[model samples]
Target: MRDIYSNVLVKQSLTPAVRTATATGTAVDRNAGGGAMFQNALVVVTTGVITDATHTITVEDSADGTSYATVAAEYLQGTAPAIVAADDSKTYELGYLGRKRYLRVVSTVAGATTGGAVAALVVLSDPRVTPVVRA
Candidate 1:
């Protein structure tokens, strides 16, 4: 098996919590570890106890951390999901093929009094440097 723990750097884009409103995740720098460049990225979203709400997950990228925009369709490997109650206790993964230096995940929730427990992780892979250091 491949050594995933050593080759990949994982960043918490969204904090795990019950979100009643929109959640804007933190940007993760692809070159954070010793200026090592990465060629691939994956966004993983995990949910629990979804109520009467529709959560639309958007994947964004930034050339600079201050400015962000939605990732283009050509740069995305899979579509961002409009997560519903039926998707409770499930995980979703989206691959990124863009060459942006920073990335994040945002969840937009609507039509809900009680929201859901949602969180996202940005997984940076194919690092130029081996054994990704802890950040």
Candidate 2:
């Protein structure tokens, strides 16, 4: 069992750049690691805004790549009131103790005409259910 992670970061970016102002991001796949399973995930969201904006970021999973759904048991820790500042950040810890085979992250921004930018980073710890590399 290899537990220590070094040299390589155990993280993935959901979107290439900050989400478009008042736009939603297309789901980006994270199962490329080819692992059979992962136990926990830490989703870090970085936000920058000029005025009021309601931004909600969530993590979703799927058995198949085409369909996705939010894990009902996990949620993120963030400020309840809408953020209307230059810099706002939060990290969500989620546990995927189910049999879902695929995962992705998404964001929703509202209440801003000229919205701000938001970025997401997900650090997933693979439990290595199978513990074997497949080609």
Most TM-score-accurate candidate: 1
Clash pairs detected, candidate 2: none
Q: lDDT of all predictions, in order shown?
A: 0.89, 0.52
Clashes of each: 0, 0
Where in model 2 is the C-alpha error above 4 Å? 1-3, 6-13, 16-31, 34-36, 74-95, 129-135
After superposition on all CA atoms, what RMSD does each candidate show versus the true structure? 1.6, 4.4
lDDT string for model 1 (50-132, tens) is: 98699999999999899999998899887888888898999998999999999999999998789888999998988888777
**Local lDDT at 35 for model 2:** 48
Question: Which regions in candidate 1 have their CA more than 4 angstroms from the true location?
Answer: none
Tens-place lDDT digits, model 2, residues 13-88: 4454444354434543344345434555555555654345666566676778778786565343432223354444
Lowest summed lDDT over 10 consecutive residues: which window, candidate 1? 1-10
Candidate 1 has a TM-score of 0.94
